[model samples]
Target chain A: MRHSDQDLRTLMRAAQGGDRAAYRAALAALADWLGGYFARRIAPAQVDDLVQETLLSVHRKRSSYDPDRPFFPWVAAIARYRWIDALRARARRPETSLEAEPPVASPEEPVLARLSLDQLIGHLPAPQARAITLTKVEGRSVAETARLTGQSESAVKVNVHRGLRKLAALVESE
Target chain B: MTERLDMMIDDLAAELAPQPAVRERDGRRAALAAALVTIALVIGLLGLRPQLVNGVADALVLVTTALFALLALAAGLSAIRMAQPAVGAPRGGALWLFVAMLLFPAIALVEHLVGRPADAQAQIGLMCLLNGVGASLFTAAVIVRHLRRGAPVLPEAAGLCTGLAAGAVGAVAITLECGGSSFAHLAFFHVGIVAAWALIGRLVLARLVRW
Candidate 1:
């Protein structure tokens, strides 16, 4: 259900007051938003980790939140910062050279080709699609994704690796 | 053109906007403040003797202590409620209440300052100044904590109120001990202190609390 701004504010205030349930609800609401956000840039596997880390940070520093303002902006700002930090960390590590390139669609390409890929991605199971998006697009570490998705780190790594192979096979057959 | 494609991408990106995260840490801070106030009140009350008890002192100490404890309880309750589900969470009124609580100490300071003999007044003034500095330190800590967590100014009103409550309680305690109860002393001391606290609270809220 769509939560009103007032509802969210009340929830936030409660969360600030040390309500675990309120915090979870707030986290759930934020997860959806963050999921879509990570889907665009990072692989699906990494979104869960980013969300978890962001939530932990939010929890650790919750006392600084102001009750008067909208809660989402504060969350978004945190997420943005977290994303930047992750990017910076990746840049510093330089271990993973296998980055997913954004799809390069030329003007001359048929609309059907783009449509087919979108449809194919959509057709994948939600978990698989999410794993692929986080790992390939968002470029989050497997451990981070596992932590966010509530799966073991090994599971996340395997899922991303498997999901990518399946997607590549699908594209080749198509 | 590529511009149109970029615009579409931008629109899609905007559509997938991420919501901000919320953390519940105010309750902990409030609890800490409450605990501190309770401890302070206990110490202040324990220090009181019949000889130290004046009319103004009695009134100030009793009122400030009780009010501070009440505010502490309220803060604690808010913190408890914050731990619940979003649907079950309490309102933001508690924050405003906390802000109101911060005003009490300023009132006490003014009351104490108004009635003392000039020689005694200087000592009280110095003590008040010292207390003010301590309170400022606490306020600074609260402000920094708020900023780091990305909390807005409105929620931190509790911290402001906590300060006020502490100030009011101390002022009242001092006033009672000093034997000043006249309307002029009460007005200049209690009311004036409250007003000053209000002003300071407003200034802090505006400058530091606003995200």
Candidate 2:
């Protein structure tokens, strides 16, 4: 069942006072909300992990909460911050697979991932985007990517590194 | 997934202990205390200016000192509030104060353009600049240390505020101690110190505060 903002706030306020039962209940409810929040922003396979990370952040920063303020925005801000962190991590990691891995992969699976990647790359300059797509996303060797893109191998490597760094910075700014 | 979360929640709940909620005032008080401590240290090491001690400091110098003190109060409190990460938190007051603080540099620039440069005291100005930056280090450490205890969503902005507040603390101390009252001196050394810290806070402190 969905808990109202007031219910969560009341529970959280009690949790701050060392009520373990209230703390557990509030956390459970927040977990559900966080799941929904992450599910909307990230791949389904990654949503659970993001939710867990955000819940940990909530636990760590619980004391930062001001009881007099509305609770939803505070938690929401934390959730958003965690989401940015997830994006930064994704931007930094080497590409693993073009196709979606199964079990948790939706039918729309890797399409969402590709679309999001395209959206991020779309923000880059044309040469940087092409170089990154050919080298990183397509997993081509630097020499092969250079041959295909008509750029030097060093240029391709530079573009890939710079592109990824820019992507990490973009995620950071978000 | 459900079981893992349930277990995690159990662990967190089990570890939970009673603690006071972090108040906005706590950060403000800490920043104030850090600024005071730095001021005291500067007094001990460099000694307060004779003009200030003799009550002969001109109105412009006194006004400049007041501005630095006010900026430190506003930006220091705002930086602390940023750590708490509330939506719609009041930060504009500090921003406006920072903008006002830029007037010193602007005035200096205009004066230079008009060929009205003040007598340059390169040696004293250099010393004041170094002292101002040195003074900022302690206060910046205090605020950033407090920030490390909490998650700041806008880490870059929080870092900027931290630098400004800390730099202002340094400016306040050095201003009270340094004898120079020239706009060029105030702009280059006093406000310049704040600018330097603001950059460090934006670049370094942001990385440190990011969770």
After superposition, candidate 1 runs with Cα above 4 Å error: A1-174, B1-61, B68-150, B153-166, B169-179, B183-187
Q: Scored by CA lDDT, what does every candidate get?
A: 0.48, 0.82
Evaluated on chain B only, what are the TM-scores of all the candidate structures, in order?
Answer: 0.44, 0.91
How well does candidate 1 score on lDDT at residue B140? 33
By DockQ, the best candidate is 2
Q: Write the per-residue lDDT of candidate 2 for residues B64-153, one digit (tens) a residue.
A: 889988889888988898878665566667668878888878888888889998754666888998889988999999899888876688
The segments of candidate 2 whose C-alpha lies over 4 angstroms from its true place after superposition are A94-100, A103-174, B40-47, B88-117
Compute DockQ for each candidate against the true complex: 0.04, 0.48
Q: Candidate 1's residue-wise lDDT over A1-174, tens digit each?
A: 556667777877776565656655665666566655554544344555676666565555565456776666666655654654565454343325235533433432324333444565676677767765565445677766667777777676666655555554453233
Global local distance difference test of model 2: 0.82
- lDDT at B193 for candidate 2? 86
